[model samples]
Target: MYVAVKGGERAIENAHAWLAEERRGDKGVAELSVAQIREQLSLAVNRVMAEGSLYDPDLAALAIKQARGDLIEAIFLVRAYRTTLPRLGASKPVETGEMACDRRISATFKDVPGGQLLGPTFDYTHRLLDFALDAEGEIPEAQSGEPQAAPVPHITGFLNRDGMIEQEPQGDATPPDLTREPMEFPANRALRLQNLTRGDEGFVLGLAYSTQRGYARNHAFVGELRVGTVPVEMEIPELGFAIEIGELRLTECETVNQFKGSKTEPPQFTRGYGLTFGMTERKAISMALVDRALRWRELGEDDLGAAAQDEEFVLAHSDNIQATGFLEHIKLPHYVDFQSELELVRRLRREAQATRQDQQEAAE
Candidate 1:
């Protein structure tokens, strides 16, 4: 008895117009420029780029602006835009050892090769809101000091000297790209790391938290965390030599986890790795924890049926865009299905009443 809804097209058009007006906000306030977003809200831009799997800060800022500050929507916009661009050549993997670090710290060691630099971090700051920032003023110039030495050695290398840490086997095998190919279960470590890198930050954080709360608890220690810029190089076919294309800001984390000795292996600390665009230490650390948790099978640990331990579960639901698409699709018309269910429920109720009346008459 349900009639199909009409004027949906017009409704959608009107909704879009309203949305546009809402995005712009008050007419008295000036429109936000993409450049301003890129410079001022650089961390947000970094997050969009990291999740979007794209590096252009300007584009990320524009996406943010267009999406009205909704980061997931911005990430989706960047991802969609990424598909249209033609793939050129792949870049050579940048070496993190040679990274010019701005901020470097180690929880495992007191003093590393280069002293731990506490570069721009909010860790020590009080949570009080700085109302002074409400009125914009010129930022004071940062004081410059003696240039620190480069090529800081990884903390894991120290543990590796005596074979205290589990050694990761070096391989030349190319990793499968989740974006390019459909995801298959039982993903390798490289593939898992790649997925985690671009996975939704909040989702990954929650999964990581579950591990610490005794759901497949793996004792994790931050071995080293470094944030800095590294040169990206690519080999040109014409030149026959790798050339430095550009430098990219990145954050890398290495976590040392305790692993019990098994039948085939001696007891040693296993390592979990995380790397992301820009200074996203929390995401990197969470990623490392989740990455280690996912490796329970490979490391010869018990599965324990943990959410983080399930490869299929983690990889399948990690993408916000895919998750949102399916979740939001429930808003679409389901009148036919609802009507059928309604009729079935009514018939069932009538049948139950009739059976009750027949029982009463028989008793009488």
Candidate 2:
């Protein structure tokens, strides 16, 4: 029971002014440009775009700047702004097989077709902090390599050819848009994927960790993980054929999980798939693990009653914006509710005291 308070326009205006001032700090320092944030703080921009369910890097960077580097606040800003935009035609499903990969790796295979390209990765780097980055320093240019003539095929394709992994048939039905429609229980794989892709990274990562730590354990192996750019295409009414709209940088993870033979089906490995905007491999991998865990029922596995296995619980609580809004609302003007609670507690205490006195007098 939240009561609305009236007549604080002046205070609210003043607070807004103060907030604006605080957002831009240290007059002596040069103000950071949106371009700098877009390029330098790219990882932050990627996160805002992924969780905000918007892909515009410039807008994401601007949101980050306006939020004063508070990522969740930036995500909130992006989501709020996203509501005002008109819906253009949806793009045709991207062919990740055609990706111009920046990074591709496989823990399951040593010698793949593309030969395991390790583009720009931090995996091999020492954890030592470089003091040279404190001051502006010129760095040598990186060596370039010749582009591969052959397309990099997925590692899972190899297993599928041998009937070692469950095959996923392509679906032609349009996926439900959660933005326009309310989320319901027993969500389809597509809806679940949409929710997981835009879910809070920390929340998804924690759930994934729990699965790995023996909670509904589904022994998952990174069959293949790739980070790259793929072309987005949309069909025009006049053209009657899809044309390239733009390219999106994406991180995709495919995990192969152990699946014992069921009564009706032969023993074959199952897959967990995750795809996210920009280079968010950690989030992508986490999404994959959680996705696999949630498919336990459909996979004919026993109900371990894990948190990750609950579809309603995952979809409902995965949204940080909704969670934060509910949480932060409690801090605002609960005076009336508190007063009511206070009165009730006092009345109960007084009644108990009176009853105790009456009982004592009767005994005497």
Per-model TM against the reference: 0.94, 0.97
Candidate 1 lDDT over residue span 265-331, tens digit each:
7899998889999878888999999999998877778779999999999988988889888898678
lDDT of 2 by residue, 1-364 (tens): 6578888899999999999988989888899999999999999999999999999999999999999999999999999999999988899999999998999999999999897988778888998998999989998899988888866999999998999999997777899989989998889889999999999999999999999999999999999999999999999989889899999999999999998876566789999999999989999999999999998877888788999898898889999999999999888888889999999999999999999999999999
Model 2 local distance difference test score? 0.93
List all candidate RMSDs to the true structure: 2.4, 1.3
| Per-model lDDT | 0.90, 0.93
lDDT measured at residue 306 in model 1 versus the true structure, 0 to 100: 95
Candidate 1, superposed: residue stretches over 4 Å from native? 1-6, 357-364
